[model samples]
Target: DRYFPSSKLCSSCGSIKKDLKLKDRIYKCSCGLNINRDYNASINLSRYELAI
Candidate 1:
């Protein structure tokens, strides 16, 4: 029962980009964090369990 929007969410500031698309390979955050999309998603997914 996991429904988190890990890819669209910023791993640094927790801000979400509603217009993010799958073709984007990089995740850029306004908080000066720019990282690979997969890495960002992985980090965000790891935080999901702790969020509960």
Candidate 2:
């Protein structure tokens, strides 16, 4: 989905970081999910389901 905020979404809590920048390599969520941005994106992508 083109609207999926993979990089900005927290894998653990499903929270979206609206202020996330490309320079921000670390993905930090208020739910205490601290992980690499790319790694987090991968996790989110893996769980993505396409709606037909």
Candidate 3:
């Protein structure tokens, strides 16, 4: 089971979701950023790899 910490990734800005809620299916952030949960995770992971 590949689990992406959606609650830990910013759904709107693609940043790390520091204070995310499990109940949030759709990311409603003030930054006007919106995206799927998995997409954020993949992007995060990719960025992380590139940094290293």
Candidate 4:
């Protein structure tokens, strides 16, 4: 997942914001979803359900 931009991606709408910076703490999507960056990343990761 090193190459994946999980933080820059909108977990709600699946939209990618390539311009998102590391300093951005809030995750906002055009789909009317606004959440914390860490929370959003966890949500997106949970969706994958990867087997370890």
Which candidate number has the best TM-score?
2
- Would you estimate the TM-scores of all the predictions? 0.85, 0.89, 0.54, 0.79
User: How well does candidate 3 score on lDDT at residue 42?
Assistant: 69
**Runs off by more than 4 Å, candidate 4:** 50-52
Model 4, residue 30: C-alpha shift (Å):
1.4
Ranking by lDDT: 2, 1, 4, 3
TM-score of 2: 0.89
**Among all windows of ten consecutive residues in candidate 3, which has the lowest summed lDDT?**
1-10
The Cα local distance difference test for each model comes to 0.89, 0.92, 0.61, 0.81
lDDT of 4 by residue, 6-52 (tens): 77779889999888788989988889989999999888777755732
For model 3, residues 1-52, the per-residue Cα lDDT tens digits are: 2464544666446556656666666665567777665666566677656766
Model 3 residue 16 lDDT score: 63
Q: What is the lDDT of residue 37 in candidate 3?
A: 54
Candidate number with the higher TM-score (1 or 3): 1
Tens-place lDDT digits, model 2, residues 1-52: 7999999999899989999999999998999989999999998888886433
Give me the overall lDDT of model 3. 0.61
Give the C-alpha miss distance for residue 40 in model 2, angstroms.
Answer: 0.2
lDDT of 2: 0.92
Better of 2 and 4 by TM-score: 2
TM value for model 3: 0.54
As for model 4, its CA RMSD to the true structure in angstroms is 2.0
- RMSD, each candidate, Å? 1.3, 1.7, 4.3, 2.0
